[model samples]
Target: MILAEELTKILSSDQVTQNLTILQQHSQDESFHEPHLPDVVVFPKSSNDVSRILSFANEHRIPVVPFGAGSGLEGHAIPVQGGITLDFALMNRILEIYPSDFCVKVQPGVTRLQLNKELKKYGLFFSVDPGADATLGGMAATNASGTTAVRYGIMRDQVRDLEVVLADGRTIHTGGQAVKSSSGYHLNGLFTGSEGTLGVFTELTLKVYGIPECVMAARAAFPTVKQALNTATSILTAGIPIAKMELVDSRSILQMNRFQETDYPVMPTLFLEFHGNDNGLEQETAFTRLIAEEQACVDFIYESDSKERKKLWKARHHLSYAFRHGSPGKHIEGTDVCVPLSCLADSIEHARKKMEEADIDGAVIGHIGDGNYHTLLVIDPDDPNDRKKAHEINKAIVEFALQHGGTCTGEHGVGLGKIRYQRTEHGNALDVMMDLKRLLDPNHILNPGKLFPMSSPSTLNIN
Candidate 1:
């Protein structure tokens, strides 16, 4: 147990909240999971403070869970074992910007919107947008990717370097500012998607892109998801370099129309964005139109004005909110699966049929250019049967993805929710992961019982 006097001497009493209510509030994330409050919540102001806190926690064998914006869907920030919740809200700062180099240094707490607002002055932007205005640290932790990821790539691709404080109070820098390197093992890759298990990310250097010379947003309505997915696959195979391609099923279209007070046809829709010079954009648009016609698309509408394009994406971005609007007082549970381009159509159809048979209420949306899709299930926690049915549907979807050549999660890291499927997905590689976990965190103090389940110390030994 951590002594009060020791903690108070390290941080101001006010900086460390011992109040149960406050601790409980910081425990869970934005999901339906029951709150498991930390024993104490500490707001650290700097990397040194984080290092000191970790040192104390390591010595005492107290679990430490790093807390970002708490906007995560999988309870990644939750302190399930009840020790210390290191909230980095105070560390929120944009450290530096190098416009010429097309990179920026930011504290973990700075959000995507905050960075973009600052970067707008340079006519540059960070592209790994995960819909929610999540913190850069949290985004890096989960390796989050969204619509733009089809072209700009995920958080891992954006992150050039990270200053991470490990379990035993050692702070290390992973990677450098260079565009590419084969210098050593990829520590950046190891820590980026570790979900705060291996270390606490204090600072990050990330890649940024200049605003496109020309941008266009378009929507294609298909008679069926098969047609929509086919159009996406066709666009990819033809090497269109589409900036973004998103699929929204008819069920979600209705929910969006109701929520946004706009009347878009309730059909499986494909939302696409193309970024390039004016001529390139025109060529891509013409190519997409031809392919859409080949796929028997019902309609293809284009929005060229930036404001109008933003409005179109705004509606699509608020899809989770739309589902919540239809099912009042219900929480949204989203599960993602990515399969090979050849298998995406069949896998999605299989998932759709399963949802219909199980009588689940949800919508399918995805970055289909990457063969990644999510089925959003709205469930009322008050109804146990509804929750169970949603879980069953999610499990089946994961199984289908795995049986085919796909991952259980495309971008969302394996926090508590997907930990059970880690072994099933990775097999013996799961043992290697356990070994890495034990090697980095011998005390098991960092985000205990997450990413992977707690295994006996002997089971984790690599040699």
Candidate 2:
């Protein structure tokens, strides 16, 4: 019997499906990368099932791609080589929640939104919101961070421990429930953004936070991108406790206005939020307004209304989708580059120039507080020139960021999209990563065509 047939023995008939529709859904992410359906999709209900599946794949050298929400933009979940795709949806569950310790242990398939809804009952929440209701395991796989990362930190920071199933079917928990540790290896950090090249996540122990006593949201409009960056940098420099600082360029604002039906000003804008004690939040908002105005803010508006606050963030989170909807059949490819705070303006300026020169049509949205931004590139699949231009613009952006002591990807992990830039970004460290990959997964049964440049195919199978 083949691997899929063997999987049926481990899981129930309903759990192991060779259905083409399911395979196709698990094949790709929300990226422009070409999709390839897996030979079969298996839904594992628990960690032992995951271990059994991995052991079988390791023995047969069949590529095992872990499928989460399929919301990733870097094509991290794509089953490049035909094999079994492991869908963790059935495993979605909150195993435990310790409000006093401010931590939660959850299964791999639980999503950020779902967990947050559960956390809300206890006045707690998982702060990393990547816009998508992405699975916590998938978020950890990418080390995802978003607007609130400015305060609560990235997925890597929130992760306290992980239960991972290895290629040979051995299961290991990386960290403990303790607030901090000086353990043997910081394995949690290693696997948080390893993109599943190392192993599959079965369970995750993550940190959570109580909802702030006071919360306020604002929108600061600027005449230019430089002005907006200056205000954002000034806010960071002054050490204001801004929970979220998102930079939305004029083009993106227009896209949002069109798609979201909101009459936001067509200018470079910062969507900011402050979290603290009631009086302290008021003071911080006043200080932030002063800095924004001093830095050429056209207008600054603040609101404590929860519904209005949600509306503002809703528009910010839906930016990529707005751009995609704006460009009907065109494929959307984005560039994720993060740099030092001091070099952010220069990098954004360089990106603006490149986009204008290449005539690549895309919208700009970023988390300015953390120096990570993305130029959501819209590419025409049929037009070779359009694809070339988009790719060239992406390369230029990556090269500039690397030269400026920045990374090729900020929040998005190195998957099929940014694999080529890994060697250039990490240099000699790339070799070490490859060695680790070999040590952990000798047969390369996990995410075989991702992360490492050598593993990814060069030709574009853009269909």
Report every candidate's CA lDDT: 0.87, 0.88
What TM-score would you give candidate 1 relative to the actual structure? Answer: 0.96
Residues 343-457 of candidate 1: C-alpha lDDT, one tens digit per residue? 8888888888888998888888888888899988878788889889998998999999999979988987778889889988999999999999999999888998888998422
Off by over 4 Å in 2: 453-463
lDDT of 2 by residue, 1-463 (tens): 4656677788898998887788789888988788999888999999999898888777777788898999898889998876778899999999999999999999989999899999999999899988789999999999999778989999999999999999899999999899999969899999999998899999999999989999999999999888899888888889999999999889889999999998988999999999989899889999999999898887899989999999988888888789888889987777689999888888887888888898877777889998999898777889999988988898999999999999999998888888888888888999999999989988888888889843431211211
Candidate 2 at 160: error in angstroms? 0.6
Error of 1 at 136 (Å): 0.6
RMSD of each: 3.3, 3.1
Candidate 2 clashing pairs? none
Candidate 1 backbone collisions, by pair: none
Candidate 1 error regions (>4 Å): 1-4, 455-463
Candidate 1 worst ten-residue window by lDDT: 454-463
The TM-score, computed over Cα atoms with residue i paired to residue i, of candidate 2 is 0.96
| Candidate 1, RMSD to the unseen true structure | 3.3
